[model samples]
Target: MKLPESQVAALNAASATDETPIDRLAEEAGLKPETATQAVFELRDEGLLEVTERESVEYELTDEGAEYVESGLPEVRLYRTAVEAGTDDAPAQMGRIIGASGLEGPEIDIALANFGRKGYGDIDSGELSADPDADADDDPEAAALAALAEGGAVDDVDADVLDQLVSRNLLDRHERVVRTITLTDAGVTALMEGIETAETVDRLTPEMLTSGEWQDVEFTEYNVEADAPEVRGGKTHVLRQTAERVKDVLVGMGFQEMEGPHADADFWINDCLFMPQDHPARTHWDRFALDVPPIEHLPEDLVDRVESAHREGVGEDGDGYHSPWSEDFARAVALRGHTTSLSMRYLSGTEVGELEPPQRYFSVEKVYRNDTLDATHLLEFFQIEGWVMAENLSVRDLMGTFVEFYEQFGITDIQFKPHYNPYTEPSFELFGKHPTTGELIEIGNSGMFRDEVLEPLGVEHDVMAWGLALERLAMLTTGAEDIRDLHGTLADLDFLRGAEVTY
Candidate 1:
């Protein structure tokens, strides 16, 4: 029998009695893993080898995990400190124990959270108690971390402990397919009869063509059904592709693109949109404030008009918040919570030279917020911001626009619930039915700008504007259950690689 050189080597290296891993077989055959893999598949096709695949999980300590392994898990450290502080005998003041524990900032919270969960102690009404029977040295999480750090098998660790470590961002788990190759009876028979290496050409070269030897050489057969190595080539991210599609769709709907600073003056981000100076959303907890110098150059007349709108109202029928609006606060810089700042800038005629009535402008840009990370929320994500300025615009026009816009993405079952926004009158929150869960998810927010908002921006004509979440739109299109799956630290690479941003 004759075979390719790589196949001959693999068969010679494979064992008849023991199943050898593909990696070890490749090492013994002095061949690359991919070459050995292809050869193994070819031999298996001819019933000369048996190939089986098994999935193995590997665990590695994250940076935080390594730190904890070096200097005790936060909970364990807190427990030891609490025991030394006599908390086991009597409840001690939580602050003193925590201070003595030397846990600072986020670590203190981590310690307190896990301290109670590990049955190490109890925290109640600003006091901490330790369980005398609970041994801090026997913590499963800490033991698991130490085992992983020392290259122990994943099976040696408790599953729940591993899960807890993963949830705490202290460990990373990865699964890999391990393939093993074993010789079949046919393979042993072939080896006993002796096999020869066949000279075969997989590709026709220019030299072969010039020498006219292509016809004389045997061409290697291709096994298209073989499990080949995965090639993850560079391509546009699904989110970016969706964002680009959005831009194209908006442009087709007769809207021009808008662009501006990601971090800008609060004046354009909020105050220009009639958000009161003292609004809760303006506080540091909700916005990423910057320490840069205040905005020195603002249109003085526009500022006066905006302040007057905040102080005295827009029209005779309009009413202002009458809050103490401060120019200093408005000039403060921060990351834009929404791309509505671009809308504010464009509508105020500061961008694109004062867009005229019957103008449409849109921006698919990133926004930052101090939001809690969850399945539906992210601290930073793209926002699809847009506005239409024309006379006699009504709620019907707003709803019709959304219908047409979403239909392009095959989302026809959009539901809108009346909501409230500080700048938009009769605001509506747009919801879309999830393709997988069959549940309605809030996708975006929209409404017509109120007189307090539009009048301050010098937009006399009725203007309808919306700040839609780009990630949520992507989630709806991709059938992703979690926004984190789309793009974030916890993103699923497999999902991203396979997700098609279908229109």
Candidate 2:
């Protein structure tokens, strides 16, 4: 049988010894620990070696612990400095003692606190004196640090001093699994028969084949399950992929994409939607407003019509809000909280040419909200906004559109809850059952536009609109419990690496 050079070397070393730890064997053979581990496992898989593991503790020096190795322990430095300065007779000034010890900042504080607590020194009224009889050579912590400058097994060090050093953050404790490797009876027999150590080519070259020499050479056996090097290639982010899929789905259903600024005038976002200026949702705490570049170029005629709709309700028997209205507030710019602003702009023919009846528009874009981030919420996320401007549309049409849109993602289970929106009359919140949990989770908001909203947009036809959470849809489709796993800096890379892109 052919084996890797590392495995062949390790087996040879084990043939001479009864049993050896994998780490010690790696060191003696000049092989990397990880390489040794991989070879040992392969050998064990072939029944040529037997391995056993036991828990072992080890120590590594902390920043302060390493420093103490180069410059004695803090207490030892304090004691040495004070002794040289004549202690117990005339006390040295605290500053002078510290300066003479060559300690600074946190080190000065550490030395002073530890010196007095360890009975190595006495501090009185800013003057310091060392215990004249105390010896600096008996520092157990210093001795421990010196011995462990290079890490060692826990049992080999003083347990009391190790604990003290750990508590002081001078050393870090780690538990390790040490593997003991020994050759099996079969391994001995195989070595006795003959073990090949010379390098063997894994593949035959064209030159060797042409020379008719490949038949005389031995090629290494290939283990398909062996670990391979990682390769990373360029690809769109998972969230971006979801957004593109959304656009594709909408376009396939005869919807034109709407593109606009992330920072837009409130006129298109709320005023055109017939939301009153004094609405609680318009508060500064809820929306982020821009300071520079005030929005001053809104179409005057459309603004006037929207203002009238807000001041006095549209159509017969409709009463308008007698509350105050301001042109400046509507003209001010802010980060849009929803892509419904895009839908409003499109439905009103402000973004595109005058819209005829039987029109459909959609936008998959980012929106901002002043929100606290959690597992399900973020300060910013993509909104899948869509609108259908057709004659005599109803809540049923809205529900049907949602069902058809979600069905493309293999989501057949859907339920609607009666919901309220200022712009849409007879609103409903759409929900889908999670594939994993089977729990109904709200996914989007939809309703037919009210006359108060459509009249200001010059749209006499019924318009159905909905704003769905793109991240939530990604979570549902990807079987992700937390929205962060689908969208955020902390998104799980392993999940993304293995996640299958499905329609």
Candidate 3:
């Protein structure tokens, strides 16, 4: 059978029974000296020939291989040389010969022996056979086909089987230089036509075209090219929509609307409402007090009652809880933290009369707080506040107002827990179902008009006041993931942008 080129060349390098240097042998054989010497050792071990250690090792094929070499036709080599010379059918022809099917183990073995004799498929160790344990059962031919698919025979081939295949005219055994991988003209055409293999080409057929399913789907071969439907238009933020809905409800309910300056002096905001000058809620952390101040002038008449209430409570012998009132504190400009400040302005001025003796009023305004912002806290937000006052209104009226307001928002799960605000006695805090977090969250705080503050304003009986935090309600309504979006900053106002106002 055909010997490895290195083995033949090494034998040629050794001359006349005298030692020829292994390095020189390697040079003649186009191999490293270590490779040449190792080939010599292999030939001797296979009983091809033996050379003394004192003399250099020489090599030759064994008797069986010699007999194979003489019998295999020279045309066998001529067929391979002619095929290799013709590039047109080389790859396909090579593929067929390499993956010869129906050759059982022993016949395939005989073919391998004949291949070596013909000098057609002789490759290096890293050329044909796959891993070390490759067997006929393992389908080395299929593995070689895969290797050719990726590129010329890969580095993962085994030396012995690769040499046999290359000798058999399957793989082109060009081992003098590194094999290169470049897309061939045929390969490029195949790729453009979306064909890689039988399986891939099978996917394109007249039956597939007849169904016209491709017409229903967008074909973005390179980039996403499906045109999206044109977005409609802009909208108000959900919180703003909520505030608007609250206002709509109040107005629809015949409650006259009222508003005051956003930067109202604390006097109009708090002192007018009989908040004791010493109340803890007035502290710095909870409230955003204006740094710049002359505490704007309190209403002359309201000031008299507010001041008197500070010294000796409101009416005769009331709670007797009075603290010195400060013109400075009352006039400091602040970010309004509660819509109730507008309510105070209503009670302290001509709006009080505009509301008949039995009157209702409401406001949906932004409020600011100074608390640490968290999942449920924001320095700025909205408040839905409302009140109805008449002779002898009771806690029942407060309940009615709360239920009505929440129902308007489609909120059914709400609990009015007993709470106390310094300005309201018998106060209750509103809590409602959180839409996403699924926890009960506080909405706002409200309570009846206390005798202490109302008497000073001159309405002595009970009046209902109720307020709910706007973000909590807005979150419930809009399924917002974060509270920051409520303040008009996180993203565009989706509420107004796409809202059909219900209230």
Rank order (by TM-score, best first): 1, 2, 3
Error of 2 at 490 (Å): 4.2
Clashing pairs in 2: 312-320, 313-320
lDDT of 2 by residue, 429-450 (tens): 9788777787777888988889
lDDT of 1 by residue, 1-503 (tens): 99999999999999999999999999999999878888999999999999999999878888989999999988899999999999999998777898999999778756765677678978765578999999887788888888878888778677877776776778887778999989999999999999999999889999999999998999887778866666669888999999999999999999999999999999999998888988878875578899999999899999999999998897887778978899999999999999999888888888777767889989999999866445787768899999999989999999999999999999999999999898888899999999999989998999989888887677779999998998989999999998877885446666888898888
Model 1 stretches with alpha carbons more than 4 Å out: 1-16, 29-54, 60-143, 158-222
lDDT of each: 0.88, 0.80, 0.57
Residue 276 error, candidate 3, Å: 2.4
Worst lDDT 10-window in candidate 2: 221-230
Q: Count the backbone clashes (under 3 Å) in each candidate.
A: 0, 2, 20
Who is ahead in lDDT, 2 or 3?
2
For every candidate structure, what is the RMSD over all alpha carbons to the true structure, in angstroms? 5.6, 14.6, 33.6
Better of 1 and 3 by lDDT: 1
Alpha-carbon TM-score of each model against the true structure: 0.79, 0.68, 0.52
Clashing pairs in 1: none
Decoy 1 TM-score against native = 0.79
In model 3, the worst 10-residue window by lDDT is: 125-134
Model 2 ranges with Cα > 4 A deviation: 1-8, 15-48, 51-180, 184-200, 229-236
Q: Candidate 2 lDDT (Cα, whole model)?
A: 0.80
